[model samples]
Target: MNYRLLWAGAISGLALHLAGLGWDVYRHSRDVTLAQREDVLSLANPSHLMIVAGTAIMAACLLGIAVTWMNERRFGGEGAFGGLLRGAGLPAVGIAAAGSIWLASRADSSGHVHDASHSHGPQQAIVLDLPLARAVGNETAARFVASSGGHTHASAGSFGADAAMGEGSAHHHHAEVPVTAEQLEAAAAFVARLRTAIAPYEDIRRAMADGYLQITQDLPGIAAHFIRLDYRNDGREMDPERPEVLLYTKRLDGTWRLVGAMFLAEGVTEEPPSYFGPLDAWHYHENLCFVGSGVRTVASREQCPGAFTARTPWQLHVWTVPTAGGVFAHDMPEIDPGAFPGAVLPAAQELRAQAR
Candidate 1:
């Protein structure tokens, strides 16, 4: 038997398999890290575990090599029995190691499939009378926001401050593909159906009861005028004609009118769509806290004790309703500063504080 060639083939297979596996893990972890730079630990911990596992796999390979060499030296490398034993043992160990690693990879992929199947979108915060920042500070307020059903709509006159805003903000971003006039006309027609079928207040109640709409957030200020809808987790696609959230404005007579809608995918990385045009921008909430009960916008997940802060999937709003920052802008027109709270950043000079 050509023992040298046999050993060469065995080692080559093992090396190639390990290298491929290592590269795959490295790429996946790198993507996760780049996407969630603020919440490094979310993926870093798992990556560390994977490193340990790879170390063990390498150690096993080395140990097998050592045992084979020792047996060859003691029993002689020329005989039929010796050759048979060495051939059987080396190939068996190499094949087993490669197969095990491949199977492990398949199992990990299955976990991701399971997660996607049970994906969740943003937490729907029901209407709250209290201030948004203060609500995050109070446990009772947090629980209420987590559980309350949306309240009555506020008057549309409250949104008059946003009416004068420019329309260019929403259409400013570039489209991924050239948006033809035909597509724009089609989108407008689809929105018209939403306007007619969905009333301001009563229809919202029916939609929620029918499981079509969910109340996501209650924008700050006296007006219960702006409530976000979570179209995600409802098996809806990020179709421009059928967005995830249908933003509504409450009229003076206490009716709700469709204003805008958000488009998004659950737990995906930076690849959010340019549904309207290239000028359209998609954003995700960073350092957001998701305790079992409520979601809080914070500087870092570390700010919330025992809370898991991870990067949220990308989402973009398209306002059919008029607003200051344009219809497709990120922030609501003339919105209260406290509507989405941010964490306080430590001073750059404070080295110890910066580590946290």
Candidate 2:
């Protein structure tokens, strides 16, 4: 058989795979859209499609080299000893060295998978009626003392349950909540401050801390519109603590909308100190995807259709507010601000304040 065709195909495939992977890395390294970057990254990893192509190419190259050596020695007076000597010859060694280096580099280029422990997104606020915040705060405290179990969704929404069919009733009864300039500034500044505070470790559990952001209409007897936080606890060092350690609660305002998010990491009390903060949203566990039929959370044992597990070891979640129909099926971006427009910088000056 002609080893020439095999060698040509192998070299061409190798080049193609390397080029594709290289472009992916370059695109991710620079600032880009979240969807585009992630899509590119998924294709470039060692265990991805590109890597499979490279592996096939490398195998073909080895086969070609072996056949070439055998054919050469057979046609001439050379034998096994001669072929072995030829294999270690200067040209062969140099080719082997080059291929080894390329494969090694490709493997190392992947590094660790991306996740919450590696991000610094925005920290937008979800301002609600003060009464709702207090109500959630109060109910969260009460539930902890009463049940001795932790809560994830606030006093308004339930994590595991679907929004009730009355969800569409808001169209007739309530008006659309308009976004305000002042509220926009507040959201921007909130994210700016958080992105600065959790500079180095902003991507992990610390990022999930204090995640509740309220988007309220600020009306009495109405749902305040709370966005819940959810996170997956996989490949992490979360300590298995006492069941009495955390308190979470959700309330009903006779409406299906969320009112507020409240978490109690420490002890129960009347206006006493709580360990968990609502800087982010408080969810039992966020579904990385909710567009499909099933839901998922931390270390979810099952895969949902239409949901892609990130090419990363991540802390993932989903945010929910009562929607016009059944529920909001939006893919809420990860709550880190560093990648947002006019985001805040994580500086040394901010470090001192957090330390103190």
Using all chains and alpha carbons, the TM-scores for the candidates as numbered come to 0.35, 0.26
Query: lDDT of each structure?
Result: 0.40, 0.32
What are the per-residue Cα lDDT tens digits for candidate 1 across 285-353? Answer: 556554432345666556766455466566655544433333334444332222222112111212235
Off by over 4 Å in 2: 30-48, 71-318, 321-356
* Model 1 global lDDT (CA atoms, 0 to 1): 0.40
Q: What's the TM for model 1?
A: 0.35
How big is the positional error of residue 310 in model 2, measured in Å on the Cα after superposition?
Answer: 31
Per-residue CA lDDT of model 2 for 1-356, tens digit only, reads 55677778777878767876686566445423233223222333443456556755766676667657655655334767666555555356556865764565454221112221122221222334433233223322211111011122122322222323456563332222343445434433432333243343322223224442232221121222222233222222211211111111112222122212222223222232212232222212233433322222333426544454432221112112222111111122221111122101112222345579
